[model samples]
Target: MTQGAATPLPTPKERRRLRESRSLTQAQVATKVGVTRETVRSWESGRTTPRGRKAEAYARLLSQLAEPAESAEPAEPAELAESTAPVEPSGPAGTTGPTEPAEPELVGAGAPARTPARKNRRAPSPARPARRRTPRREPAPSERPGTPPEAFDALYAHCAPYLVRQTYLLTGRRALARESVERAFQLAWERWPEVAVDPDPAGWVRAAAYEYAMSPWHRLRRAHRVPEAPPADPEDRKLLDALLSLPPAYRRTLLLYDGVGLNLPETAAETEASTPAAANRVLHAREAVAEQLPGLAVPEQLHQRLTELAGSEKLDAPRSTTVRSGGEKRTRFWTRAAIAVTVLIVGATALTVRVAPTKYEPVPAPGAPISGVPPLTGPQHMTEHDRKLRQRLRAELSGGPQRLAPVAE
Candidate 1:
């Protein structure tokens, strides 16, 4: 019915090939997807499928150079649903032929030549039950966001406040928490695909916020004055103090699992630890937090307290923006340059110590007998009187005359 219809949209494989044909790296694709380069690789390799907001982003980028996805049309012979038998196409007289497109003549041709009429066809088999499990997790139909970018925005908004709140409780500083949320959102935007598709997107950002706030890089930044901290609630203050008391690993695990509401496996993946280790960290951290609480704190109560502290604090991610590739590249270049400079400075300091260059004049070799007495360690063989006489005679010869002082008798 249409002559100028657009070509069909490229498949994911075709999309990746087109991207590569343009000499674009996975990083470039990731920037558009708001995810890291690795996620792009995963998509291309079929390790993961895009869904939710990620699917939208991917579709948009691919669409820029692609055609519209195919529209509904007559089913082809090979792919047609098997509810009905197939029609045989006309070729030459008395000659079998393959199926062909429906033509006005073929519509009524040869009484709709049916699929090779089989003699005594067997009874149709019953439909198989749906598989209980699939190799890969399909996006939950109910959980999927109705809109594409809306999902990304909704997640950003939802996680922002909690991230800020959680980070604030962790650091006891509102400004720092804000900074953590800002950084986490920026990361989430850059890695939007990965975060959005994650089973627990909220947990991802929460963990990221805490990690940002607790980074060793912030050790020196802690002394700066924050505009606010947790209110004068004893519970909040006590929990913060107790949390900071545990080792960093333990602290992070506890917050991710209990405070951020992540499952133990999710917590382990986020913290980059083994499940057993994460479990242990949570166990010990809970014990430590329990000891610090005012009353007999059970597991449930501890979680409740932590949640309260995190909830009471709030970090509003005021912006959901993605920095440009140029900016990120520039920043990365400078970072690498700074690291190189630091390495050079350290290496120079260690390898090339400054030592005072000493003046090393060679001692004058003893020449023809110096017309002076060889005294002390030079020659113990000569007597003191002989040495004095020689010294006196030498002085007399060098100088025209010398006043002879009375010698000690």
Candidate 2:
């Protein structure tokens, strides 16, 4: 049959008769047909007609209903299934049904044909009263001020997987998800009094997780990223691929709304955006998501599928193995490293401060030169010109004629 071809649905009376013949309730039949009980009622009352795949599903269920009543065995009732009482075993003993062909009766035999003897059966044990379990006592409020340990545990159980999955989708890295969730939870723990009292504690943690997931700190560890596909079912793999194609901010807005189950205002507050902006982001993201769907799906169909997909896949649990949060550890390591470097610099500078010979030479005494005039530094201490000048100056001072003397000297 063609995929789009609508299967013929049995008429109202026929459908009701088939349902009764099989001893099934409307709810049971609706579950089999993948519709609500009201839908089943509407179908039986000729109020509406099933269409497309839904019609096909109804047709398939009708075929099952056509089978003999003995062919179907509904599961045992909850009480019977969980019953621990010893069975009150009583049935026709030593009496066989005609499951096996009976041997030909002896001609004109007075005694009735004897059936095969039944197997030996054991007797039931006596019933005993169920032991009552003692109720555990709650710890005093003095031990835990506002929110108790149990409350935090309950919070963690609810939000941890949700935050992790959100981070994982955002970063496309499992380790980052764990790290983000861990950091978010740590912050929550530190401010439990406030967070516990807040209207949306999960919102607070989710915002923190989003921040951690998008942190630039992750860039330093990019080299350590091992290229691998996310753990997903086939359909989810396609969805993830589509999601990765979207811009980071848009992708985040989408997940926060659909994946994280936040409203426009909550998502906006977390994203530090206006409500309109968040809505716009969601719309854009849906458009982007729609592109990832196959050719068979129209925009409306794609949207419906996406909504269903989002609902179905909370990804509340991760893979068996995980790379837990190392952000805190890394922070501590970097802090120590910076401190060590600072210490080394300070020590080296201190050791270098000690005086060097050339740097701290003692000042020489400032006094008159040994000679009245500086001694000549050349090979001939005095030049021939100096000799003449000296002779002229002595002649003049001794009252001799100054003519033809070296007056310049």
Candidate 3:
């Protein structure tokens, strides 16, 4: 038997728009489609496409959704047809106009229909060349609508507690986990200019916390050298041990991918690794964990377990105000220290200049001995005069007046 041609799906963006327009949640869609929400998310993200029977079902659902719009307005069918028509090149010979916007997955039975872009545009004249448009620059963090401080506080309040729990899983030490998350936020606050503008601010903080939690330097600390008390439950203890047993990279990759529910590309990006490497790490970590606890062989089970393990512990994050204040204090201390060092260097330089020799000096020539002077000698080398004196002294011992008269003579 011959199979029918496959349905042409809408762009990823259109797929998402259709669902949102219908006021449907990903979970509701997942339940209807007999797939997980993550699968639906991946489909909408354009990371993966639906295949075979699911594709047909999805296409039919989207057709039904578009059908209402078509039935509601007599004039919409033409626009819908134009939306589906293959985009024609309207620019120079080598270039083409922009393609359809990214869309979400389809949900119904018939072939998927193309959805129009957010704004309607007339076909460009074939004679007119398409000009290159410079991309619009995003506003700086400070330039954003609300107060930056408030934005930062909001971000901290939302992410800190979750990060602490995640860090605990990464390090298997509750105190260190809390410390890692707090330190991460402090660093984030310090670099708020950069962190505030990031597409994934929470991820920026998470990466920092993960890096700090897994740092080799932590191993040198006396407290970190000793393991923390295991979870009270044997299952949790076993799972935690298994996670700790994996290499730091693998453990982090697994957590980001499975536990945190990030897609493969997002996980890889956060881990600073290539997608393939992240995949390998996740696979290896999963195998290792499953070997230890056979019941957690599935990714879903592992995710649930990680959540339970992290939630069971009392890993509380410091207040946003505390983190902000601490960061400010650290910044001030470093600034002061830098200034003091600069002053000290200048003082030392001034002192060196004050004591340094101003001009070159030459050594004096040694004195020459007098040509006619007799050579100096010890008592053993005395001349005839010295011997005669010694004899006169010996004879003078007879009388003091005689010796004095003789000496005068």
Candidate 4:
């Protein structure tokens, strides 16, 4: 049958019998119908009833099949009267039943009421008392002032092994374990203001570490690096090695859920995966770890190792190469000064050449007037001999004797 298809409605007698057969009090039916117990009682006694939508909803609930009643006999008149009477009203308005008299059973006492049992099965179960639990006390404000340094320290002290395990799982390199943790802590320090306020600092660190381990920079750094030997403890080392060998996705989810003790939903949230996806990741990671380390115990030795590793070491502060040593600044200052002086000297030499004035000397072609000198007033058409003698006379006047060329052939 298709889901949500409307089913057949129940008769008033069927509804009342269903509720009673299911061991439901009148109030239960009243609550489902949004009426008082008096109303439910009225419906059962055939005096008053729900109609339209309310009636349909009542019928739907009563249509549910329930377990067969223990006794086959019809209820005694007194019991029937008591069952149909209005009980104390509970829940909201429109849920109370109307006052009414009881009706005779539709079937004889010996026949089992299959219809009632079917309807009663659908009746809602009785309300249960809500459990009360003591809330966990939060750490004092003084004890947990949110700061990058505080968070980094806490993660290093309390959550290092899990991180190491995660790093190992991702890269399968023992040496990267410490570096990954350090890098994750460094990033946390850089963004401490935001990270410290997070509800789960360790989770934040783990996620950051996972991201860092997957980054190109981390990959390049680890490529040439050799794996460090596992620790002396066989169990501890074995778990670490196994974790390191897991794929990144599986390793991250597993560490978050198993190593870090987060619930499935919490792990999903931390890992940015759906709950089902996170569950799958965890399942695969567990299987992988189990397969790799058959003799390895995940619960006992791994937890102990993680705890011990967390306490034994501290995260070192990130190093800075930005600080200048003595004489370095002085050397740079002198270099700049020398370049400035050289530029100025070269500029002055170029300017001197560019601005200096050039002296001019005049040259005249044969039979042409000397430029910038006084014009000659001799005849325009003169014999070649006269021209030569005049040129010689002019040359003599200018303090240089001129030689006349012989006539050309």
TM-score for each prediction? 0.43, 0.42, 0.57, 0.39
lDDT digits (tens) for residues 1-409 of candidate 2: 2223354555565566466544477899888878899998888777898887788888877767755422422221233222212233355784322222222111001111112111112221254222222333566876454545556666666567545655666777766667677777766765767777654566667767788888777777854366755545777667767877898889887766545444344455567565557767876776677666654123233333334443344444332122122434555788999999999999888777764454666799889657578767777778899999999899778975557756675
Q: Order candidates by TM-score, high to low.
A: 3, 1, 2, 4
In Å, residue 170's CA in model 2 sits off its true spot by 2.1
Worst 10 residues of 1 by lDDT: 104-113
Model 3: CA > 4 A from native? 1-145, 361-409
Tens digits of lDDT, candidate 4, 1-409: 1112255444444454456545467788779778888987777666875677777767666655222322232221232223223344654753543322122121111011122111101112255222222334668988883754444565555555446654554555555555666666655665666666554556566767677676666545545365555556666666667776777678777655544444344455556555557767766776677687764333333333444443333323232211111124545777899999999999999999898768765677569655688766985678899889989888778956678889988
Badly placed stretches (over 4 Å) of model 1 are 1-149, 193-200, 222-230, 294-296, 321-409
lDDT of each: 0.57, 0.57, 0.69, 0.53
The sequence of per-residue lDDT tens digits that candidate 3 reaches over residues 1-409 is: 1123275676554566456545467788888878899988888778999998888777777776655433321121233224323355677667543444332111010011212111123333477432333334676977654977788888876677777888888889989988887888889988988777654677778878889988999888999778689999999999999998998999988877666655444555567565556667877887799899998875556666877888788877788888889989999999999999999999999999999999988789899876887766755776899999989998887565533334553
The lDDT, on a scale of 0 to 1, for candidate 1 is 0.57
lDDT of 3: 0.69
| lDDT string, candidate 1, 86-194, tens digits | 2445556653333332221111111111211111111223542222211345569887777645676667655565566666656677777787777766676667767
After superposition, candidate 2 runs with Cα above 4 Å error: 1-151, 191-194, 216-225, 230-232, 294-409
lDDT order of candidates, best first?
3, 2, 1, 4
Comparison by TM-score, 1 against 4, better one:
1
Number of the top candidate by TM-score?
3
Please estimate how well model 4 matches the true structure, expressed as its whole-model Cα lDDT. 0.53
